[model samples]
Target: MRRDKIAVLVPEMEGKIRILLFWLVVMSAPAFSQQAPKIVSSADTASIRIGEQIRWTVAVEVDSAAQVIFPEGQTFSPLETVEAFMTDTTRKNDRLLLQKTYALTQFDSGGYILPTQRIEIDGKGFFTDSILVMVATVPVDTVNQKMYDIKPMMEVQASRWGWLKWVALGLLAVLLAGGAYYWFFLRKKPLSEEEAEALLPPYERAMKELKRLEQSRYLIQDEFKQYYTELTSIVRGYLEEEVHISALESTTGQLLEKIELLRDAGKLDLEDNTLRQFQNILETADLVKFAKSKPELRKAEEDRNKVEEIVQKTKEAIPEPTEEELLQQEEYRMAVAEQQRKRKIRFALGAAAGLLVVALVSAIGYFGFQTVKDYLIGNPSKNLLEGEWVSSSYGYPPVILETPEVLYRKEIELPPEAMGTIQDLDAFAYDDHRANLSIAAVSTVFTKTDEAPDYEGAVDQILAGFERNGARNIITKQEEFTTVSGIPGTKVFGRGNFKIPDSDEFLKGKYAILLFGGNGFMQQVVISWEEDDLYAEEIVDRILNTIEVKTVI
Candidate 1:
């Protein structure tokens, strides 16, 4: 029994000793790393000719997972940098290599001490060794060369500014003569009787034109064509001169448009029926003159009487100008005349100033706008701007949009996460996502949130998901953007390979624009179209301008 028990205890003791040895070996073992972090600094040549460039390089070796912050804005005072290349990054397995190169030059010939550069990696700081550089002037072959003494300085006759002085005197003399002429002749002239007559009131001017047209004897000679022409001209001229419209040049349709515009602008108070009567008269006159249509004598007379009625009604509708308004108008005319006289007096100066202004504008239009546009960049789809656009609303929160054409509602299957938070989603799309010369979309969703949505994060996720579906080579740049209605959101824009619909052909020249805003409701606007489509960009802007974010509590 003792032997069996001792044998069992011995086996157990041996097993325990083996376990202890394994533990000791494991604890004492050295750890292994795939890459060791290091930094290197060197120059292509330690010595350089004065004003010549020295290729200076700094390289860092770090682990792929490590964060390395290289020195920035490092100044070499005596030796200036001509060009500093951006930091280049490369990876080899688990290690990452970062290299920065600079071209340094020194004008003064001397030895200068290069400053030590600092690098930070994973919260640990490392430094580069300071080095000395020699910048020396080029050697001359004096032993075999002949040196000459400096030549004596020759006296140059100073350029004469006498011509400039004469020009100034001439300009002054002309200005004085012009001033005297204006003072004695133009400014001193009083208004003549005919000139005063031309300044009659609006109603008075209309009456004069009507009376003159009547005296032309165009009505009785059966120059009915001439009669109606003169009558229409008198009426149009009266409207142009009195009502401040370009009625004489306007067609019958154009007259109505202009009148409507004035009515909307609160500048004119003409009734619809009055405008309809005016249109009818103009149309009848056009028929008589151009269409060779002979109207009955009574109908012609009736049309003439209708024109007279319109004139009377217009005169009655003319509100008596307030005393202050009449005075201002008179003063404005006099001031304009005075300015014209002054301009004649200072014609030379004004011409010079005007030329300078024109030159400045030309330069800005050609140069300054280009430079500012480089810095003040906006969405690239600015080419498609046009006069016609259609506005419509879509989705739960009603995403209002103004696009080149009305957007057709598109159905999309929502992801599970979105379905949970979103109660309803409505999408509107303009194109089929293929050959989208200019495609646009607007979406609004009713979500279960009273607080403002995470627009930035929401856009990120949206872009991420968008990249996965049909979209390849996706690149996105995000910025804080605001809606036209003052709703804060995110602006995501970039170029990517847009997949065409129902085909395998992928186009690389396309821009993707996305805007997102939310509160209790979420709104999204997306526009992806062919690259360099200025018309599409203009449409995108129009659609964006109509974006309105609504919160439904």
Candidate 2:
């Protein structure tokens, strides 16, 4: 019985030993294979002249198939390895092969040691031995040499073409001849005063008719339609004579359009309001004529009065002839001489007054703005707490903060509850080359104490009490860690679609918010929105990241 028990225990013991031995072998296999790889470099000592190419090869062999990583900052010396090829094998017939070839050339004569490359196989790393390479000096020959220095070849200067000079002179001669011919043959004949007076009849007749209509009493007699018709015809006839357009034949709207074009081109001196008044009178007349509508007696009288007033006003405000036209007219020479004398006096007085006013304004504005900026910077706490701080981004407008109580009172003023909710509130400052204001929050009557355990504990909570009730497509991207107003914070950029209540489609737009804070007070939070999603969040991130409290005083 004892022998039988012993035999059974022995077999069990042997089985346990074999299992342990198998595990030991498995663990040692990795350790043994992790040994450093073997590396050998050719050319222990070699000589080469300057500007001569030298070829070298490094061969490495490892125990098993393993990945090799080169050493950091290791390179071939005086020799650039142009090509490197590596080979590996796992079969009993063949082994792993790593061959590296380097082609080197040196400009300076010096001996150099080619440092060994670092090889890494199966997490084990080793360095190969360094090889020496000698660079020889260039040979000098002193025989068959001349002692005197040779003169350098001179560059020839290009000569100017005489034919081009003659051609230019010929062109000038031809131009002079043509100008002489024009002066002698094509000169305009002087016109007699009689001929000039004859040319004035059309303008004179139009002016006379306008003056007669102005003095007439048709409007006072309640004939508004006829009065306006004759009045418009008189002015139109004058325009036809003065500006060469058939204004009388055109509709009121068409005539107004033509007048506007002429005004823009600087051919007319009629004020916009005056032209608009004419259009109103014509439109009213058309309504009475085409729509068969009757006008009030008082309005008819006013229309008639306006017609005569417009004709006289337009006649008095006729534009003077342009400089080119003045040169063509005999009367303009006298007008120009008189204008030059008046212009000199006006220019001197105007320039002196303008400079004085500009200097005073510039000094006042500069000092005033500087004082205000200094005050704000000196009292950041007061400035920040006095008003509810509000900011906006591109595609948005100014968001005003009414009071501090609104923010610290724990009330959230969402879009629906707020009066005149804002969208695309973009505030830009020229100095920073970036949007100064982005991210906005409004307070409502909803308080954190309404649902939380306590106010202080509620503040400690992350993303609690605050509701994203109306925010759409909200995406948040974590930016670099930073501080605002000396408060440690992390930047998070959020962008999404937004819509405000009781507004047009312009109020529905994209918005970006930058939330920065850790535990205590948040130094600054910027918000921006745009009508279009134009990388507003990216711009917000850039602004928030660059926001360093220049002065916390």
Candidate 3:
């Protein structure tokens, strides 16, 4: 009996031991969780259309002192990584929670597995849970919506304004240049010393001349004939201007007789002694000039002094002029000043004209006439080609391109029946009708998943859109094209006739279109310009070369 009881108790005791072990493990669970880091993975959405974005995030909680590492580079397989956002951190109770996010996308339509992401904390690797994502195709309704292939570029005639603009610009430039020249070079200048001296009254000018003669070396060099000639002319000029007599042309006897007449008539009130001195000096000058007689230097000096004395006495004896005479003199001086001012104005205008002509000729010689004309008048195509270019990405899948200017967002209105077919669409454009160049970029996202996009049909609709905007007689040439990033698409180029607004006439123009479609997403670029525009042609080619479409397969 005792042996059987002990056996029963032994089995029961084993059961009790198992129960104790279970309790111990339950109590230690919190301690284990606290010792190890916690990692979690999540996504903003489980299903996204192709070319749409998926915000994938991985979060880890570890000790504050621990170092954490996240996956880098193109580590996410089956999906293209658009961007990697910076890690976010949060602190709680001596622990740090780090969260890192990535922008992921796929170009092809299918289901994908977001594999477990590896994370590291304090030199140990950890992993987050795997995730499942669905990439759906954007659909198109070919049966209801009309579609067309790409159209060729058109030929556009040059506008009269093209040349007219250049003419206006040239005139403006000439005017500006002429004004600048006049301000800097042709404006009135201060009077020079000789000019100022000539404007002085006769008595002051004569005295200045005498002082200047005294400073000369003519007497020292023994140039007596030249000296006597200049000496007599100075006094004669003084007498002619101050006394109103013709002293310069008269001989010594004629001059003396005139002075006597004046003195007798009371026109000049001169003393007899002063008259004698003046007569003597005039005779001496005639002898030196006509007979080649050389007088002693001392005699010449005395004669100069005596002449000066005679001039002073004559001036003192002369009566003051009447008010009428003074008024007449003042009017004469004003008239002379007005004539000089007019003369300066004429000279400035002539010089300005000459400068303009020279500048125009030089510009024409250096650059071709057409090129210069276009620059001045402003060629829209040329300016667009040479101006600063911008490289940017647009649309869902992102069409990367370069353009002369930033494109503005264009609002697209869809018909009521088509609204159900298209989920979203974005457009950007730059249109210059005067320059005959129009460019646009468009991207579409479809709603239905039953059918793939009809690329050719869409191209047809785009060509028709051109007609609605004034295109006519389109001739298109379609071919396959590939972007820099190896994204293949359709290219159409041809010429067409475009109607001029408010006129019956149509202009020859050129156009090019590139169409790229996959699954439910479609992107397009259209360019049109006047034919024979080399600058526009170059712009189109460069823009085409820089195109790139981001895709994931």
Best by TM-score: 3
Worst 10 residues of 2 by lDDT: 394-403
TM-scores of all candidate predictions against the true structure: 0.32, 0.28, 0.53
Q: Give candidate 2's TM-score.
A: 0.28
Which scores higher on TM-score, 1 or 3? 3
Q: Scored by CA lDDT, what does every candidate get?
A: 0.68, 0.51, 0.80
Q: Residue 278 deviation, candidate 3, in Å?
A: 3.8
- In model 1, pairs of residues that clash are 381-537, 383-534, 383-535, 384-534, 384-535
Encode model 2's per-residue lDDT on 1-553: one tens digit a residue.
9999999999999999999999999989978756556677675337776445566666677654567664432177545443343443333333455665555554456778777766676677676777777777544221221222222334544334435666886898678656554554466658896676555655576566666766778757766667667766766777777776768789877888888888788777788789878888888888876776678867866776776667667666668778877676666667886786577557655665786578657766878854444343543223333333223221111112221222221233335642332221223221111222233332112222122112122222222212233435443333334344343333434344543434332233333333222111122343444544234344444445444321110
What residue runs in model 1 are displaced by over 4 Å at the alpha carbon?
Answer: 1-387, 415-418, 432-447, 510-513, 551-553
Per-residue alpha-carbon lDDT of candidate 3 for residues 1-553, written as tens digits (9 for 90 to 100): 9999999999999999999999999999978766578888889999987557899998888888899999987788887676799999999888999999998876567899988777978788888887788998654332322333223333545447646777897899788878766775577669999999998988888888877877788899998888889889889998898888899999888888888998898889887878888888888888988999889999888887887777677788778889998999999989998997787677777877997789878999999888888866868889888766777777665666888777888998899988988988888998876677788888887886444666656767877888997887676655668888566777777788987767778888888888876656678888888888889889889999998764321
lDDT of 1: 0.68
Clashes of 2: 22
lDDT of 2 at 279: 85
| Tens digit of per-residue lDDT, candidate 1, span 1-553 | 9999998899899999999999987876644544567899999988986546788898999888898887655376666666678889999887889998887776567799888877888998988888799987543211221323323444545445546656886898688767766665567567896787688876676677666665666656767777778778878887898778999888888987987887777667667788788888888889878886666767766766677778778766666788998999999999999997677658756665786578667767878865445323632333224334565556655566666666787778987867777777677766633236555454545455554554445555655765765777655444456667565555666677866767888776445455554445556776777765545655666666776544342
Off by over 4 Å in 3: 1-232, 249-267, 276-306, 319-338, 341-349, 386-400, 409-424, 447-450, 468-473, 502-508, 550-553
How many backbone collisions does model 3 have?
Answer: 25
